[model samples]
Target: MVMKNTESSPDLIDLIFKYIEEEFPEVQDRISELKPTIRKEFSGIETYIRQRSMTDRENQIREVMSLFNGRNATEVARRLNISRATVYRCIKTSAR
Candidate 1:
């Protein structure tokens, strides 16, 4: 549960097992038995979080703004190889 910005998604899965072992030694065996399911759930959550993180959105805006000349979100999107909608969204977000 002590997540760090430097830790990748897979690292969270390993951290969970370590936490369980440290905090609930008696249940370690039971948790190990459910490792596969736990990892699957963690992976899904990681994907969800990565997609929704504000840091990621900010990065997108930074990239878009770097290439923006005030009127070329489409060109910026093409240069960045991202969706036009994504560029537009970043523009809207940065405006706030």
Candidate 2:
């Protein structure tokens, strides 16, 4: 998934607006009135949580990659149940 920085984030506030607009159009005015204050409070917390999650996922993938020694990309991919392309990308990324 593509990560969004704070300036570009569309977190729970956006979701609530969308849900209100789609499912309860009659309440649209009320939702819009609440969007800013709610977004200001939640977006920072949401972005921090997302960044940490990405770091954790990348570390886990790195750990999985470290378990293989001199294995071909295809073999490593199969062992890890990931695509060969992903394995190759990981190897290239880790090298840098």
Candidate 3:
């Protein structure tokens, strides 16, 4: 036996909207207004991640430098898997 679809597109949409309005009344205004802020929210998260990455890099460099007794920059860079230039830069920045 074949079944015919009784609901039209508008009818289905109306039913969905009514269900949403009843079940989620708080977000009804956001749904109707539709002012998306996804990019703004994600940009804030990206900025936070960037700042955290910088802080972590600085801390790692400081720890490596502190562990340096009489090791050369090349050895320190090899041990840390960073460039010798980065080790030198960290040393230069930390001295200031």
The RMSD of every model to the true structure, in order and in angstroms, is 11.9, 8.5, 14.2
lDDT of 1 by residue, 10-71 (tens): 57667768888899899887876788887776555634345457877788789898888888
Over the stretch 1-96, how does candidate 2's per-residue lDDT look in tens digits?
A: 976796777756676689879998888778757887787766657343353576876875686578657577777777778787777777777778
Candidate 1, number of clashes: 0
Per-model clash counts, in order, read 0, 0, 0
Instruction: Write down the lDDT of every candidate, Cα atoms only.
Output: 0.79, 0.72, 0.68
What overall lDDT, based on C-alpha atoms, would model 1 receive against the true structure? 0.79
Sort order, TM-score high to low: 1, 2, 3
User: TM-score of every model?
Assistant: 0.48, 0.45, 0.44
Better of 2 and 3 by TM-score: 2
**Residue by residue across 1-96, what tens digits does model 3's lDDT show?**
986676643443356566888998998887554323533344434332253577787897787678666568888888889888888888877878
Task: Name the runs in model 3 displaced over 4 angstroms.
Answer: 1-52
* Runs of candidate 1 exceeding 4 Å displacement: 1-52
Selected candidate, larger lDDT, 1 vs 2: 1
